[model samples]
Target: MHIEIFITTNYYIGCFFIYFFMLYYCYYFYNMNRKSKRILVYGIVLLCVFGMVVVYKKNSTLPLVILNAVRFYFAGNPTEDVGYAPVSSKDFTVSVLASGLTAPTRIALTPDGEYMIVTQLTGEVFVFSRKNGVWNNKSRLAGKIDTSVLGFPPEELGLVGAVFSSDYADTGNIFFLYTYKNSEGEIENRVSVVSLKERFGTLVFSADPEVIFTANVPGNFSHQITDGIGVSIEGKSHLLFLIGEGFDAKRAQDLTLEGGKVMVIQADGSNPLGVRPYPSFPKLQAVGIRNAYTLAQNQYDARKRVLIGDTGPDIHDRIIYAPFF
Candidate 1:
């Protein structure tokens, strides 16, 4: 089944009201009594009038959300006695399952390998689980956690990383890494941990996220930016992440600003928590890389070697075997 996304002008109209509500609420609270109340009401009315103007203008211009659908086809022989493995076979029934997901860019399985956490770039975390051999719909992980509050640009920010504790079977701690844009037009890399519960065979995750750590990084192109994050092997509240150099690769040389660098920290502590400098690590672990978008521990390695896929300039792609020194 093919899914489609359609744009609407009311989206901006709704956004105006939301922005005005926040602004007016503060105005109403700062100065009490009839005067403030009147001001707040008048401001809200003006915002409503402006919202209609924006809605009408937007509706007159564009009405369809840009969308793209990718289809994958297996290309090999299907016969058992024949050549290469094929995507279609009698024993291997194939079907395309669709989830009502809006640009789900990242997916990770729980440490128990029982639950799948899918993150939408549009500020939504959808959790899927298998029960009796059936995949269920979304179990919202970070429901309505406004990405705008993090100061991350909507086009550039996303729930980028999710992982379970190495001891998740024993401890229910789950970790997350996402982008937030502040009012200063700076992007922040945020991390947190939460627990999952099986309520009467229904897997439910926590709503109130416990912050683990946060690092501010600069933003590049809305689409070309690169970032990476993952939990350490030992799971002693440690995390590893990569910040990109973006358009200016030289900015990574500045340590005071976490640009084009890998950062390590303990999640169970305060800001700047037990941070280890990325430059101090082994040079061979990472070399000639501009931006890294994905990070993971190689399960094949006995020591669980850290692997990074750094998206290089032009069309270059570098996969580095990064081991913690």
Candidate 2:
């Protein structure tokens, strides 16, 4: 028989089993010679019938339709707010600006605040703008980071962060941090720049990127790549990025490896601004971070400190403070 027909027939078979079991139980209870045997058989039959009915309803579509009907009648519409209480705030009103974004990790706004670039962890960058008081997708920016080449799963190792240049209005340079497997098939994190242009009245970002910095992740273990890409609030020429411990907690303490360190590099791929005591890695600024998932500069404070949210090792997640160099 056809698969659909067989499945449908199974549902009826389950109902029949329950019906027969009940009838037999009732007949045995009234006319059985042994009272104890009757009770035991009834219990066993009830359990077997219940199991069959549960399995059948779980696999059949009819139960879903019945359940939804019951919910609608008793619980009202799922989208309707039956007992919602509105809370008012004197300072501000909150609302959703956009929806249907896939795994959005970072958002970067243009220098003029005319447009916003939202980066998804799957390597797609979407541009949104407020048109007629509603934010909508203007276009999708193109780039050349091959998400398939990453050694880890897409969610674990794809585009993590993005930041627009301070001269973005003039140069349209945008920076991104992403993960990809090197020629040796080892996972590596990279920071690159791409120039955005306009053609035919639409924004056209570069499909080819100019890679400025790259660091090799030591092992096949996934889960902690560099995150939180941002431009220095003090000077746009300086770029700040985080390097995770790459699943090795000890690497957070090691200064030699780039893992678990916050790095500063020139946007133009030149040597960093400050004088370096060690020539081995001049860009290395701060250490002892397990996995800095997010980074932000304090624009409100005059001191201009960089705030870091670092993931901990089974102990406690921490928010760290460091002065922006």
- Give the best candidate by TM-score: 2
In model 1, what are the clashing residue pairs, if there are any?
7-65, 150-180, 150-181, 151-180, 151-181, 151-182, 152-180, 152-181
Over 1-325, each residue of candidate 2 has an lDDT whose tens digit, in order, gives 5766765676667677767767876777656669766675877677665655565554433244345456657865445664433376675666666667666777777766656778777778777665555566445555445555432122356777787765676678888887775676566777888888755433557557788878644532343555554454345476778888876777777777878888878877666766664567787778788877788888887877888998876789989887764
lDDT string for model 1 (228-324, tens) is: 3445434354556666665566656655555566666555633233334344542112334467777777778877777878776677778888665
TM-score of each: 0.61, 0.65
Off by over 4 Å in 2: 1-99, 137-144, 149-155, 200-202, 219-223, 229-236, 277-280
Candidate 1 lDDT: 0.56
Worst 10 residues of 1 by lDDT: 63-72
Best by lDDT: 2
